[model samples]
Target: DTAVSQTPKYLVTQMGNDKSIKCEQNLGHDTMYWYKQDSKKFLKIMFSYNNKELIINETVPNRFSPKSPDKAHLNLHINSLELGDSAVYFCASSLRHTGELFFGEGSRLTVL
Candidate 1:
């Protein structure tokens, strides 16, 4: 079974549009996180949830929100998407705060 998965490997849209990316993990992990990889390829943690509880929010804009209904899924929703939001979003899962993570291939968002 796939450890983690994200939908729409590529997304292209114009500015001001809203978009959401779904993420799921079947590894029975308790923590899931959303990370953004910018044009420079620098990975930054956006949010993390453990057992459906928000554990971390790394100063991300209000335009970006993450929702986790359970231990195995975490989804990201972006409102009023802008060109600056163009980047690769990766969904990952780990057993706890400091553990090896399993990442999805990535969902590329292109806002023009």
Candidate 2:
């Protein structure tokens, strides 16, 4: 079974449209993370949800947010999306304080 799974593998919408990507992990990890891979393929940490606490990266815009209703799931929601938001969003999970991360297939969002 896949350790992590994300829905809507591909997303395409207008610039101002809001969208979300759902992610679920069955590994029973304590932490779930959201990463954004830019066109250059550079991965940047966007948010981390651990034990119901959310840690947001300072560089992440307020328009991007992570909502975790439970430990096993973390969903990314972007409001009023912009052209710059077009990228591949990956969902990951890991044990508390661990270096190893299991990533999902990733959701590609294209804004026009």
Candidate 3:
């Protein structure tokens, strides 16, 4: 069984369109996070949700929202997608706020 799973593994959308990526983890972790990796391969955390509390990175735009429906689920919603938003979004989970993270395969979004 997959530890974590995300849908629409490959997304091809035009600029300005809105899209959502859903993620679920069965690792029984208390913290879930969303990390974005740009084409340059630089990975940065976008958001972290733990016990219903959300921490958003200052660099992340308002258009990107991370939702934690439950302890085992974390979803990302992006509005007005732009060319700069094209990248691999990864869903990850950790046993605790400072625990090792387990990441999903990642969802690649391409904006045309």
The lDDT values for all models are 0.95, 0.92, 0.89
Q: Which of candidates 1 and 3 is the stronger one according to lDDT?
A: 1
Show where candidate 1 strays beyond 4 Å.
Answer: none
Candidate with best lDDT: 1
Off by over 4 Å in 3: none
lDDT score, candidate 2, position 21 = 100
- Poorest stretch of ten by lDDT in candidate 3: 50-59
Best by TM-score: 1
Worst 10 residues of 1 by lDDT: 92-101
How do the residues 1-112 of candidate 3 rate in per-residue lDDT, one tens digit apiece? Answer: 9598998799999999999999999988888889999999998998888865785554788999878878899999999999999999999988774669999999999999
Better of 1 and 2 by lDDT: 1
After TM-score superposition, the amount by which residue 26's alpha carbon in candidate 1 deviates from its true location, in angstroms, is 0.1
